[model samples]
Target chain A: MNLSRRDALAALAATGVVAGGSVALADDGTDGNVDPADGVPENVIGDDTVAILAAVGSVVYPDATTGIDPFVETYVSGRLSDDPDHRRGVVDAAAELDATARDWFDAPVTELDRSTCDRLLRELGVDAVDPDPEGSLSGRVRFYIVNELLYAFYSSPTGGRLVGIENPVGYPGGTESYRRASMGEETEHGRE
Target chain B: MAGSDRTPAPPADVCIVGAGPAGAIVAARLAEAGHDVVVLDAGPRYEPENRERQLDAHLRPGMEGPWGTGGERDAYTSSGERHYPLNAARVKGIGGSTLHWQAMVMRLHERDFEMDSRHGVGADWPVDYADLRPYYAAAERELGVAGADDNPFAPPREKPFPLPAFPPSHSDSIFAEACEALGLPTHSVPNARNSEPTDDASACVGYGTCKPVCPSGAKYTAERHVARAETAGARVVDRAPVQRLVHDETAVDAAVYATPDGEQHRQEARAVVLACGGVENVRLLLLSASDAYPDGLANSSGLVGRYFMDHCFAGVGGRIDRPTRQNHVGFNTTECHALYDGTDPLAGVKLEFLNYAGPSPAIDALHADEWGDDLLDSLRDSYGTHLAVGGLVEQFPDADNRITLDRSTTDDHGNPVPDVEWSVGPETRRAIERANEVQRAILEELDADIDWIVGPDETGPAYHHMGTTRMGTDPGSSVVAPDCRAHDLDNLWIAGSSVFPTGGGMNPTLTIAALSCRLADRLDRWL
Candidate 1:
């Protein structure tokens, strides 16, 4: 049977996800191993939620040289620990994606093949899996998934290299040296 | 240094509150003239070693420092018909707001002094621009201003700038071409930053982070003057916030301030100069109610906290067809003032090209759904090609847009916080609309694709606070007289933008410094 939006929400609630509240992991037998270097606390969000964000981020930022999985994991874990609204949105989106996968592929979203996951994401529009009807599903994904990835990429030294600026502000490239250009030869009536 | 340790306050020939640009200048001059001068600042002192960490903190998103504390968090409340984010715009260190200023120092137009005669709006200053011209020259020399000598837009001056104008950057080239095609005139902006290495400050190396903190001492901050004041035999006390003015019927007798440890002390002086910023100056005055004056200390005219004004600012940007390698450069290197003296019914506008080498974060926020190859391509196309232009529109002083004490909310020291009530008038709105139209036309001339244009209604803070305790010929309507002395008090003086009767289309720092120098000369004779 297909899972309705209400059924998906109820499944999330059953797993300890409350509306406008902190999300607790469902313990679906996945090890919640924490990497101290990643700067995210363990068991803040489910491994499944991190996997869902990774899948969406890979499709969204397909051109990234360093794959989006690690970025997604770090960003999601950090935001889930810091902001409650972020946790709620992420948990609900993961639940909705799992419910849709069950209805279509008869398995959890993280267990689906890459090709099937890509096709399913394409079929469901960016705004299709909105957990909160009042808010945009696409916007939630953009903020919780897409925006964080873009910020990480663009603010990096690699991203600055792509844009042709050396050591952009807010980065650790200390103290630059460059010659100031002149406004061309000044005409009698100012620069022509 | 007047050490932070709580000692009995000493008697002085001159006691200046707030060791910012104005207070530092006055204190330095008075001490040089052999007067016993002591200056007190409400914020802590910062050294060069603190610059790198503060710069990093400032550049990080959502980690900017608070007003008084160096990097500590603090908050103040504001409630009125209009809510102004007063905390974001103000700083309270010994060097004051100059610590975070971009240092675009241009003289006020001559017409800015004669607003009543020329525009039929606002009060005219008791002294005109010509009266201030010599002191302006002195201030330029002291602060190391760099500008082109032959620029036609500047007011007539007898002496040239001390340093040559900074060479334009890639963004300046782009802006110049567009301005030329549009029949607009462009000029090298006058800046307080050093173009060449001087003995005191280094030449600007284009770090592109001048607003929050200057990594190098390339741009002038008021702390240099505070250091000079200390070297010239003036004592400075930090983290000393003044609470009230102890006054008699004729003059201010002493300034009572509280230390960080909550101990109160009083510094007695023959003359007291209030050099705190525009909002805080008025708040201090309104808080100093006594038996002689029930309303406030300087409220005999009931105009202590009236006539607040700030420049109306609007931002517009577009993406150009050609890419330029102009991402990290000194900001405000070029400007166009052709629209400054227009025939339009609204006030004039000054358009400055914001030279940053990155895509607009506001635009990034809108494209949250974009990802993958599409995102990369879009970033490449928009990154170096994006150009932002901002317009600074003149706002006439309105008596209604004022700052009052919010008695319900108190600071950590239990004083009433300042509540700012400010709004743009119809003339400012019309001027902003016209400025946006001009910006779009310039972008079109450059064959650029328009990204977004924010109108006057969507304008943000310019942070040029002025006109609270205005100077005027009439004591009934203004707080200060021709020499910035309190109209009712014999020995109470004010320095800074708080005394500006009408704010011009340019930045007000140089003028504030000039007025402080002039006030020092006047006080030297009176003392």
Candidate 2:
């Protein structure tokens, strides 16, 4: 079934009925309980970025098609709470990328355009390319976004199959036992 | 494959990359046979006459982070994303992985070589046990390993051990007694550390930190062989990553490398031997994708980054019911238990009672998660009383499990880093479950009520990734032939565990070392 506004409304009604007013909200990727319309979460990924993600991630990650929660969660986690070093290199190309993300969105990146989003991301240094450490912050953020998107993509079954990694599968090898060694007993000098 | 007869860069008779044991062996043998040899390594040039660490970056497990030890957590691809050929951390120094490895040299049983035919699974190595037996002996001699030579499962050898086995540590004796009590035979283990000096390096003092960089240089590494090759006039370039294996579809012409300064330079050779390792070797092949062979250089079968394997490992630790002190005779006994019954009908898991290093504080904290204050008091009361049994499972070959390069993700060198996509299959899970049952049974033998049992965790990565560029007789099915020469490209050879089609639940260093020796003799023919 298509996830229409009617379906969203019905789900929202159910959530509201199930839990009083403090139902956990994912308006901008925050884990806390908050109302989506009232206000946004602290450091939310933003509406436009989320829309772009829903688009790019849908193509990039197979998990998006099946709606696997863990991979999605990891992707969001990588974006909002990732280390600076993990950011996308596009942020390094700085001005050029920021403008493209905005132009691609046809507005501010806060309301990005999904169709031309990845292309803009590539221009900003999202895909594999020479790393530009010159532009630090935005570049780092872009890198993080890219990282999360890729992680989710691989975590998906399709991504896993294409890459040849057997995720959620059984052992590829066998096991055995033999005697070896370990640390010595602790003594007055020190633990062996 | 660049589709041009653009003469190979910096021409020489032979060019070998990475001055590790594998690389050093190939270079030394070729150079001694009067070939103009050049070996490129990404480590400081170590002069045997006078050794000093000039910008050495050796990273071992215990010494976390990229500080004193030369290991780095910067291996993740720059796609700002996932990187595979995942978890392979090599020392850029002259010695390679040997710099931080425990010098426990052991070979796969005869059954390991023919695991495919015997078990109807995995792929059989192109060469048989008999083909590698002599090479194993040669590698052991060169490394100066100390063993009892009485191991029932150990491959046969002509050379008597250079020295006796290192005296068992306090924990070793306890293991022997327990194994014997349980009707299991135990013997002293073979090690590369000398009780006395083999030549330049010192002997083992049992410092208990073998995983980190060895300060005494007692451990056998490519550093020694590199020195020998250097003495024989073989020039080794350090801090250079061989970017491409400059080759056409039919022949390996030369090697293209990026210098430490990031300047690109090409070094040509009549023959190029690859000992870069299972992960990097295959990755470098995939990345050098050219027109003559669009899939990848020397990748006729498209198997460059496929069939990745790691020995499945998990702990079997139990708290002593009562107060008991555990000590050592030393490390791995000559003989172990009846678990690794490769020849028996009851064989399922490859069992070895290892004397593993102490658990990290993080692991201990996890183990002592419950019981709060009582846990602290209990820990203090029974510290060394905990006995851990480790088992190595054969990581069978699966084409779906591999070391593929993430074209979308680049590395520090502006090159695509490997994005490892690994997860166990049903067969692996079944094996783990079966082996875990055995581990639990053995732990029960120690005490009545099991105190703490730890098996496979959710998120774990394997350090020993093997079988990516697997060896086989058929050029159609494998990347390299039995002699480790690339099936698609003549004179392009590889040495190390990367050639292994199937691993029999054991360490790959000895087998790699033996293969290096074998490749040396093969390269000596120089047809």
Most accurate candidate by DockQ = 1
Where model 1 places Cα greater than 4 Å from the true spot, the runs are A1-159, A170-192, B6-8, B62-77, B357-382
Error in Å for residue B400 of model 2: 0.4
Encode model 2's per-residue lDDT on B1-527: one tens digit a residue. Answer: 11212223357888887777789878877777777788876555544322111101121111133212223322544121223334344565577777656667776777777766787777778788888888888877877888876666556667787777765444446555666676666656678777577666777533233553444456677778877877787777776777887677788776887765557778878788888777778877887789988888888898887887776664466655542222111234433535564433222345555444233221232223222233334434444455666656566788877776776657667777666666655555556666667656666776634554445443133357688888988888898888889888878888888888987666678788889888888877863
Residue runs of model 2 more than 4 Å from their true location after superposition: A1-192, B1-10, B43-74, B77-89, B321-337, B343-348, B354-382, B448-462
Give the worst 10-residue stretch by lDDT in candidate 1 chain A. Answer: A7-16
Tens-digit per-residue lDDT, B54-161, candidate 1: 753453332346234422222455554456787668778888888887798988878888878887877789999899999999999878998886556778898878
The candidates' interface RMSDs, in order, read: 9.4, 20.8
TM-score of each: 0.75, 0.65
Please give the RMSD of candidate 1 to the true structure.
Answer: 10.9
DockQ of each: 0.11, 0.01
